[model samples]
Target chain A: MQKIINGKAYVLGDNIDTDQIIPAEHLVYSLSDPQESKKYGQFALSGVPRERAGLPDGGVPFITDGNYESEYSIIIGGSNFGCGSSREHAPFALQKAGVKVVVAESYARIFYRNAVDGGFIVPLETTEILKTALKTGDAIEINLNTLKLTNQSDGQTYTLVHPGDVLPIIEAGGLFQYARKAGMIEG
Target chain B: MPMTITEKILAKASGRDAVKPGENIWLNVDTLMTHDVCGPPTIQIWKDEFGGQAKIWDKQKLVIFPDHYIFTNDPHANRNVSILRQFAQEHQLPNYYDVGGERYKGVCHIALAEEGFNRPGTVLIGTDSHTCTAGAFGLFATGVGNTDAAFILGTGKIWEKVPESMKFIFEGEKPEYLTAKDFILQILGDITTDGATYRAMEFDGRAVYDLNIDERMTLTNMAVEAGGMNGIIAADARTEAYINERSSQPYTVFKSDADAGYHSVYEYKASELEPVVAQPHSPDNRAVVRKVQGRKITKAYIGSCTGGKMADFVAAARILKDREVKVPTFVVPASTAVARQLKEDKVNGKTIHQILSDAGCVIAPSSCAACLGGPADTIGRSVDKDVVISTTNRNFPGRMGSKQAEVYLASPLTVAASAVNGVITDPRDAMG
Candidate 1:
């Protein structure tokens, strides 16, 4: 696992639910297919503006239609990120779309587990002050070894908590790999 | 150290005498459930990662339900079932309830309990967030994602953290008009949606014990809405009897220590509570039913794991027995067993099913119909600009069918009463 990551951040608001991350309508594609990654990546945030059930009509999209992966690799979000639904596809889609780390004030339990168990993305916890300090398109650098995040754009530094017990899974590239190494399953 | 019920269950699953909050351990799952929406992908990932020759850790423990998106005729929806059917056959899975068969169950959460997988002192994981419903039986249960479920499919084990426990003591007797839905909505309203995130919600007190198993399940079912890792109630005589009727498996009954540590404790007087509804967009955006009265609606839906139990239907039937529904009302049984119970249950002289049918309610098949906003052909789906009062969890934007359609979540009684009046009517008003 990368101990340090430097990337641009995409900011999202509170309660970024599983439907908003990846709607049920776009989940028709089979995960068994070889092109599953590309299919999921393309539809990663398609529901951002139009699919949320009861919210307002429009907001700033975190991942636009264009090639966003090239410009951003981190997602900065408010409280209760991934609050609804136990769909792993939320994190899977973000990982497939090239999101590496998700920094949130807090996360829904299942999403935090999925991010760690699937090793699809790293979920880091920070204070509300850090959430307010960061902005979309800001150049951020995170050092897991040091438990700190640096905003290169503004020369600000913030403390972050590395999700414990998740480091081993990330180092092994996912739960299955970690399980194999731990001898819980046949290698 | 003294342990909460959640900690105790996790400790047993992880082969420990005791465990603490935030301690991660490998859990030997007693059961893992996957539905049609996530089942195919889970199977796919299992095959991809574990190889074609890998065998399931335990066929008896792996339950598959093709509940969501099953009634639709769309090819994509049909394909999901076919995949599950093929996988079940390939694995010779004993628990796969294929669609169009006598064994087909309805919602996975309800069927899990009905089929006896929700034994006390067991660790249950499902692909749906509502999997927490099983915790009502005095167990530790929570939802996982496709990848984690796939891992369980191959290993029969999951890595989990012991969540902190929050104790909710509901004092006093619940009013007749207030159902578990209203109680949970009141808690959600007070705590907001994320109040209990990453914690175990341990519900107890005289009020919770007074509730039947179905109503207890409702409390646990919506715990996820509060971002709770799981919701649990201790197994008493009622829970034991309920499990004994459905299952023969030997199980332990675990309870929290008298001095067990809790992250927080919330005490409520059940008698003081009123019928409440979660307003548009969020389950935590709640208001008293009296405040939202006369809000016109185009549709009324009464089904889903949260509201499709036999007791829920009986409550709705009590209100709609003699009245004709004013709007397009739909009643979907959560499972075939519930539907059968409805057919067999008599109110006065007519079966519950007959009363509902007589009242112009569309009695659909037992499935998660229109809950996840199924294909275009899904029955009871909300259309453009439709204001629907549903009993399903989650009214997020585009939740039912159309982004433009608005959804208000309420109790089955409230939904039935609202259906009769073509508006959001409080159950108390209609009961009179």
Candidate 2:
């Protein structure tokens, strides 16, 4: 029952810290409700008028606010995603917003583990795929079973391969799920 | 394989043979703590992943506090606290600290050590990067992602890559006013931000020995900013004495062998360091404080695992005790215990509270607060004239308030002095 959606796509580059993920002001709420803090992305743009021109209405579903179009079922960001605090909310917020998987060029060591634990599949794919296959508001389909991503806009498809080491965690539905399947707990 | 301090500690915690660099080993955590700012998201993931089971590990092993976002300025913060409160109740966590009095714990690093959660020869992990501060007490500590923390909570174990260690040999007379903070700042500037990525830094030299336990803690607390996985000082007599002064437990001594191998070696003199500041956007872009002084400041914040130490306060107090804070100042004590000590010191006026209040300083509950633009900041939108001098690590734009607002990083003493002058001024000049 992994929820799949052709949610709005918002693209961000790389090296986003937890502070940017959830500004210190919005951190006062529970992590389960990240949609409530979604508006803070405006803080990232400094002062120019927030250009949500290509963003989906009601804000982008899969990506943060103030982001534009993207075609990949995942985001192909630069080196180091989730580099700051150990705040798990960074990933949870993404998952809750319908990010089926985040395909980063590289990820901070800590953030990589956090994504899988939340059951948000994050596959490490080539950043080159981000060049043409993805554009803003293009609907993309994600298949958890096959780990495939398809962009309906141009009938493009890309095979999402989990990083060699991270495959096990994603297969188990996350760390806690994996722990249960390992019979480390009493039923 | 040669073992680094992180590997050595990981090996000890795992009850295994030495762990080599790049090799993954599961380690037993001596202490695991999370603050309100970082802990809530972790707890949510934990519950979503684990479902209705009392934690897989002992409750006594976990510590929870709402230190970062306690002022309840926005609805999101209020909801966040509510979630933490419920989690604390369901988990029945033994060390839950709220936002006031005995219930009030300041920053998680100081709270853990002062409350005896950081024991010698132990490994502690927190969701906050400053967790490395525990290394001052001879513990292996680092910040982990919420996912990692949740896994540890459920299994009482974590995975780590034994990092290589770099040795710094310092030999020289320490200059007056220059402190361990200045020494570490120089090291950061030399190495750059990515210099120590995934590396263990072992601080040595006669200069290190000259620093007391509190000052040493300041050095290690910000090691994360240097991309260092851990910062450790070989447990010497000073370390032993520090432990003995506070605890009844006996801890065996640990040190590098006479010829223990290191990945790299560095040498620096203590007397050579001047007041250094890491400009905004990066912690490695360090410049001499004198280079940035007189920069206008709109707000001044002094608190965090690094700046709220007793010595940091003493230094700030010595300069600002009877003075007025130039910009609106916020002083968040690192721990309730530190606050109590500040009270006992009779810091200038009738009490530390009255004295700080009279000096235009706003005393916030012990938490990260305005240091991270948490509810503690009431400043309006960022303006070109507004600059903030903060003791906390990291000055990324929008980190304190508006992205347009400027932030200058410095030591607590420097921050206090700057606040009194309404501009960035060297603490040495204020001392003079």
DockQ of candidate 2 (2 decimals): 0.37
Q: Provide the lowest-lDDT 10-residue window in model 2 chain A.
A: A44-53
Q: After superposing candidate 1 on the true structure, give the runs of residues whose Cα lies further than 4 Å from its correct spot.
A: A50-71, A129-132
Q: Report the lDDT of model 1 for residue B432.
A: 56
Off by over 4 Å in 2: A1-14, A33-73, A100-106, A121-164, A181-187, B73-93, B248-252, B346-359, B376-385
Q: How does residue B326 of candidate 1 score in lDDT?
A: 98
Best model number under lDDT: 1
Scanning candidate 1 chain A in windows of ten residues, the lowest lDDT window is A49-58
Each candidate structure's TM-score, on Cα atoms with residue i matched to residue i, is 0.94, 0.83
Q: Summarize candidate 2's per-residue lDDT along A15-70 as a digit string, tens digits.
A: 55656555555555444544544443333222211232222232334334465212
Q: Write the per-residue lDDT of candidate 1 for residues B251-332, one digit (tens) a residue.
A: 9999999999999999999999999999998899999999999999999999999998998999999899989999999999
